[model samples]
Structure formats: C-alpha cells, structure tokens
Target: MPRIACLHTFDSNAAVFEEALRATGLAGVSLQHTVRADLLAAAEREGRLTSDIAEETVAVLRGLSAQADAVLLTCSTLGPAAEAAAPDSPVPVLRVDAALAAEAVKAGGRVVVLCAVETTVEPTRHLFEAAARATGAAVSVEVVPQAWAAFKAGDPERYRELVARAAGAAKAAGATRVALAQASMAGAAALLPETERPLTSPTVGLAAAVAASRG
Candidate 1:
C-alpha cells in the first residue's frame, strides 16, 4: 500500500481526512498523520505567515517526504509552504487547497470560494486566483462570518450549518461554482442540498495525493 504523510495544522483535521479517505475509496492507503496546531497559531498571532513560520513548515514537509511516498499539507494557511517545499522534496508534496482550487477553476465561470477563518481568506483567494488565471475563471472569496468561532468552540454541527448556509446563499446569489476553501469545511458540503453542494478539498486532495504516490 502507498504511504501518505498528512501534515495538518489542527488535530481535528486528521479525522476529517480519515473520513474523506474512506469516501474516496482510498482507505486502503496507509496514512501517517502529523498535527502541529502551533504552526497555525503562530501565523494567526502574527496575522500572516511569517518567513520563519514558512521555513518551519517547509522543514516539516521535507521531513515527512522522506518517510512516505507522498506528503499532503492539509492547511490552507500553510499551503504556500507546500509549494515552496515541493521542488526540493523527493516525493510529491501536495497542497490540499491547490487541488480544490484547480477543480473550482475548471468550470470556467464565477467561482465563490468560502473560508471560515480570517487567516485563510487571503491565502485561499490567492490559491484560487492563481488556479483561475489560466482558465479565465472569475474567482471571489468570502469568509463565513462566525463559522470559525463555532469550530473553535467544538460545535461542529453549528460550524457545518453556518458554512452550508454561506454556500447556499452564494449559489442562490448566482455563483457558478462554490468551493469550500478548507479541509475542515468539507463536512458543510454534505449539509447543503445536492443542487447547492459546494466543492471541497479533503476527498479531492487525497485522491490527487494517492495518484501522485503511485508515480
């Protein structure tokens, strides 16, 4: 079985990936998880991803690459670090949101990218805009108000509900595609009706990582 090293900024994300793996029918792949909440905490404290934080994230990604067939970075805030580390890594280092952004841009129209946290807004916007550049897809990002608070308060039910509402509203407002910008927000996709369901990262990112592992 291929070994996938998953680097997550939140401990809660590990379970999100586990569930996503099963949903993607890649449960047979071996997953090695490393959770480093402090990495995101430092970024949140600084109000941005500092140079030192990026370096430390790269170091972690490089280290994980050595032990697994592929490395997947599951935090959107730290996603740029994965791109920085990928060229030097022996194995493919995949950024979860990158895959999500790519898929969102493929529809070639108005894409509304939803993020729960303030810290993720800019990074998520940049990721999707970069992905949209080539395809001429118009990308816009919106932060789901108060959704992150519910997530931090350990009320996943409320978090998903809020996120789902934001997505549904965006779709009703004329968004051609709605993309959930974080792996943690994946559950919100299930909460929305099928017609309004948003595209999410975890499952798509895991499948891309597994395919990369094979090569």
Candidate 2:
C-alpha cells in the first residue's frame, strides 16, 4: 500500500482532507495525518510568515516524508513552509492549494479565489496568479478573510452564510468562478447556489496527489 502524509494546522481537521482522499477510490493508498497547534497559533498571531514557524513545520514534514510516498500540507498560511520542506523531502510534497489554483486558471477570466483567513488570502492569490500566468489565463483573485473567522468560531451555519456573501461579492466583482482556498471550505461552498459560476475545492487536488503518489 502507498502512504501519503497530510499536514494540517488548527483551522481544519485531518478528516476533511482524508475524506477527499477516500472519495478518490484509489487502491493501496493510505493517509497519515500530522497536526501542529503551535504552528497554527503562531501564524494566526503574526498574520505573516516567519522563519521559526517555517522551520518547525518543515521538521514535521521531514518526519512524515520518511514514512510516506507523498505529502500534502492543508494550511494555506503555512504554504511557504510546506514549499521549503519539499526540496529536502525524500518524496513529493504537494501543496493543497496547487490543484485548486490550476482549476481556477482553467476556469478563465476573473477567477475569485476565496479564503477564510487573512493569512491565507494573499498566499492563495499568489498561487492563483502563478497558475493563471502559467496557463495564459487572465484572472482576478479576491480574498475573503471573514469566512475563516466564522468557521473557526464553530458556527457551521455562519460559515455557510459568510461563504454565500463572499461568493456574491466575487460575482459582483466580475468573477466567473469561485475557488475555495481551504479544504475545510468545501461544505460552505456546497451551501451556495450552483449557477453559472463554478466552484473549485481542494479535495480534487488531494485526490490527484494520492493517485500520483500511488503510481
């Protein structure tokens, strides 16, 4: 069996990422979950990247990489840390946002990349822009910081409510599609009306990583 490591921080649970992996139905692949509350708290407090946090996170990934065929980091705030961990890993390290970014680029002009946290917003924008540039797609990315605060506050209903509002704002801003920046936002996206705008989630990216790692 192939093993994949999923690294997460406090805003999301490992199960959400694992559920996406299970939905893929790929044989001989299992996921290992790693969580670091301190790292999450630090990122939330600083609202930006720090070398210390990055180093701690990379240490976690290094431990996981020893046992897994591939790794995926679910926290958008720690994306730089995840990337820094990648080059040194014995296995491939997949950024959870990568697939969603690619999907957003493919969705074409004026793509709205919605995120729940302030720290996540800019990093996600950078990811989307990179993806859009690579794909030759003209796009616009917006960060919805309030959504994450609501979700972290433990009100699922409120999270849904905020996501709808964010989606509406994105549409008004000329976004043809919406991409959820975190795996935890999948449920919130489902609550929104399905119309001309398409919704992209991180689940598909995790699934793809699981499959690629298995092969």
Candidate 3:
C-alpha cells in the first residue's frame, strides 16, 4: 500500500478531503492527516504565507514522510511551505491547489476564486494566475469575500448560501467557472446546479496528484 499524508491548516476535518480519494476504490492506499492551526494563524499575522514557515512545517512533513510515500498540502494558505519543502523533503510534496488551479485555467475565460477568508484571496489569485500563465491561457480572478465569517462561526448553512449567491454573481459576471479557494469551500460547489459552469474543488484533484506521485 502507498501511504499518503495530507497536511492541513485547520485543527481537524481532514476526513472531508479523503472521501473522494477513497471513493475511487483504488485498494491498498493509506491516507494520513496532519493539522496545524498555528500555520494558519501565522499566515493571518504575516499577511501572506511562503517559505518563511518551512522550518517547522517541513519538520512536520519530515515526520510524516518517515511513514508515508508522499505528502499533499490541503490548505491554500500554507501551500507555499509545501512547495518550499519539496526540494529537500525525504518524500514527494505537492500543493493541493496545483491541480485545482490548472483546472481553473482549463475552465477558460474568467475564473472566480471564491474564499471565505479575505486574506486567502490574493494568494489564491496568484496560484490561479501562475497556472493560467503556464498554459498560455488568459484568465482573470474574481473574489467573493463574504462567506468566511459564516464558516468560522460554525454556520455552514449560511456559508453555503453565501457561496451559492457568489456563484450566481460569478455567472452574471461572465465567469466560466468558480474555483472555491479554500478547501472548506468545497461543500459550496455541491449547492449549485449540476448544469452550472461547475465549481471546481481541490479534493479530488489533490488526491489524484498524491496517487500519481506514488510512481
């Protein structure tokens, strides 16, 4: 079995990301999760996240690496730390947003990167811009800054409602797809109609990336 470690900035809720991975029914795959709200707090204070926290985060990854084949970062905020640690880490490391960002680019035209946390907007925008640039695709990012509070307050219903409203606005604004910037926003995608442009979530893409890295 190939073991995969998913790193997160939230204190818990890793299982939410793993569901789609397990749904694949690709037997003999082990999944592990590591949570560090400290990283998220640091990002909030620093105004941005980068290699600055690599020392501590890398140590965490190192510990997980001893027992896993690869590590996947599930938080957009600390994804850069994973990118920084990948070069020296004992195992392969990947930012979950990578695949989602690429998908955003492929979705074409304007991409709305929706997030509950206002601080996450810019970093997520940069991720999407980089992906769009890599594929020679021209795309613009739009932000929905109203839902984070609800998620933080433990009011998922209100959070989902805000996200759904954002999706409607995104459609009206000519967005080809709405990319849920935070992993937690993944649930918002489900609230939309199936025929909509489609809201892309990172869970499945991140899981697939980890599975592919096993080779």
Judging by TM-score against the true structure, name the best candidate.
Answer: 1
* Weakest 10 consecutive residues of candidate 3 by summed lDDT: 197-206
Better of 1 and 3 by TM-score: 1
Off by over 4 Å in 1: none
- Per-candidate clash tally: 0, 1, 1
Give the per-residue Cα lDDT of candidate 3 at 80.
70
Predicted candidate 2 versus true structure: per-residue lDDT over 102-129, tens digit per residue: 8777856677777777777667777878
lDDT of each: 0.93, 0.74, 0.72
Pick out the ten consecutive residues of candidate 2 with the lowest summed lDDT.
Answer: 193-202
Model 3 spans with C-alpha error above 4 angstroms: none
**lDDT per residue (tens digit) for residues 8-55 in model 3:** 887545866677566566667777888888888887777776466656
Better of 2 and 3 by lDDT: 2
RMSD list, candidates in order: 0.9, 2.2, 2.2
lDDT of 2: 0.74
Q: Which residue pairs in candidate 2 collide?
A: 116-148
Predicted candidate 1 versus true structure: per-residue lDDT over 1-215, tens digit per residue: 89999999889899999999889987569899999999999998998888999999999999999999999999999888999999999999999988899999997999999998888888888888988999999999999999989998999999999999999999999999999999999999998789889999999999999999999
State how far residue 73 of model 3 sits from its true place (Å).
0.7
